[model samples]
Target: MRRSFKISFLLIVMMICVLSGKCRAGDRFIRNSAFKGDRQIIVTFAGPVSDVWANDISNFTVNEKPDPDIMLEIEDSTLSLDKTSLVFTFKDPLNREVPHCLTLKQIIADGRSQGTATVTLRKNYLAHLFSVFLGAVLIQNFVFVKYLGLCVFLGVSQKKSTAVGMGITFTIVIVFASMLSWFLYRFVLKPYHLDFLQVIVFIGLVSLTVQGIDTVLRKVNPALFKSFGVYLVLVISSCIILAVPLMLAANDYDMFESLMLSLGAGVGFLLALFLMASVRERLELANVPTPFRGMPIAFIITGLFALSFMGFSGMSLF
Candidate 1:
């Protein structure tokens, strides 16, 4: 037992070191020996930071004097986790170069003043966007991978028509949830340093957005709302819808990539829903065990659908 404990302790220590190394590897630091003051310094980050913090943490001391012209700030954090890249902006906006360490130091000093730290910027655009899209659709898919919102996935997938409608609704809700969450995170919570309130704020946002969407749909098209609103309730407070955006916002994906991720996730949800619905409808006519009539068969069908989506691996449509 003692030997086992020692082994476990060593493993924990090694893991901690590895994690700490990764965390510190992103620190924005520049040594004076590497300084080339003549050239414009471009720094890109792979994490989160604020403009005020960037200005504060990023310092410039040229010949031991504060270098005003050397300061740099975030151009944007919108990045694709799959296929994204950053284009460095120079004093001449048209001129671009690879980001280096010096610029990062300037950003860190800037962020320090603003009470923020280095935020990671996307290094490769195309790869990151593609990675994000694929990850959402496959690795962390809302349906098969994360198994979130299964209630709606199974409940509304009874007919192809209903499935499509639910899919469309799901997409819209997810996108809206992402947008609202991003806004609340950046504007409301972060400002007050109440970052822990993310969960509460997001839940509030989702409920309010769903309610608003439901009200609008009822006012505009009562029949559509009547038919799909039931399913909407099932999805109304889903964490998946809000979680994706919160994650994207935290990681600082650009607008387009965020949209793409939401879209891909919606698609994955639709795909699962449609497949399950088709299987369940067919099962209704087939001889199913009495014990496994409704939910049991539906669950079995979902399992099969999940298995099938797994086959989509190693295939890239985009």
Candidate 2:
């Protein structure tokens, strides 16, 4: 029994490795390939290539995906002086979010060897995910740039402790709910032609997630839970939480992308809340005009924060 169990475990692990795309079995002639910037491919060969074969445009083909049908137009194909590398420049920028396939045909290398092979090219997958994460956190911040989640942004930002606590809780809820929404959209609704029911379905998922969190938090740490107060209930309908799921569905983001985006949005909202709390805390001490003491001054300060956050727009990670 033990031996059988071990064998089963090993089999499962191997299957996972293959499914995760870690198993690349390309020919040795194709030493390596990588995406250069976003529009070019840098392929290193096992040996120096013949200049004649390397320059022919027909010798190389680029496709958007593994499917042979969706080919990209190559504007130029140049061989490095050493002839061990080929640089393929495309007419348009490659989509960083999707993997591209490159095929080499009748390629003579080292003045003798000739072969054909295909390689999968993509921006470092983890790097792409990081770019997506950072873009969501800073570049596309919901609170400051998209004008989202202001209700909680204003309601809980009065005290640093409150703001920070709400931020943490909101992060947990948003990530969990977004993933659940993605699963349902990708598997259930999309397959069944029920896309129209997404909004109503997501609302239920959010409410369910918030309810579960509310119950668990009420038990594990009542202080933090009580600190949440009515705002915990408000998360069910918070524009920030709801928007993440809708964005995931609309953009057709994969599981990792959905997670990064939801997580980034949560963290951005937290930053917004903390900053407001800090400023508001200082304002409580400083002398202020009677008319603009509370929410009024807070709004003006928030506008300034939004303006500062606009500086992040220049960052284009994708």
Best by lDDT: 2
Q: Number of backbone collisions per candidate, in order?
A: 56, 0
lDDT of 2 by residue, 80-143 (tens): 9988988989999987667788888867865664667878877777888898889888888999
Error of 1 at 85 (Å): 20
- Per-residue error for 76 in candidate 1, Å, reads 32
User: What C-alpha lDDT values do all the predictions have?
Assistant: 0.60, 0.85
Highest-TM-score candidate: 2
Which residue pairs of candidate 2 clash? none
- Regions of candidate 1 where Cα sits further than 4 Å from its true position: 1-127, 221-227, 249-252, 312-318
Against the hidden reference, what TM-scores do the models get?
A: 0.57, 0.80
Please give, for residues 1-318, the per-residue lDDT of candidate 1 as tens digits: 896899688657645743564342244232122212223334444444344433432232221112335544423322223211222323333111122333233342333532223332223556656766777877667888677877667667888888888888888888877766765665567778988877778888888888888998999899988877876787774557766866866775545567678878887787777777777678778998799988887777777767876776655432
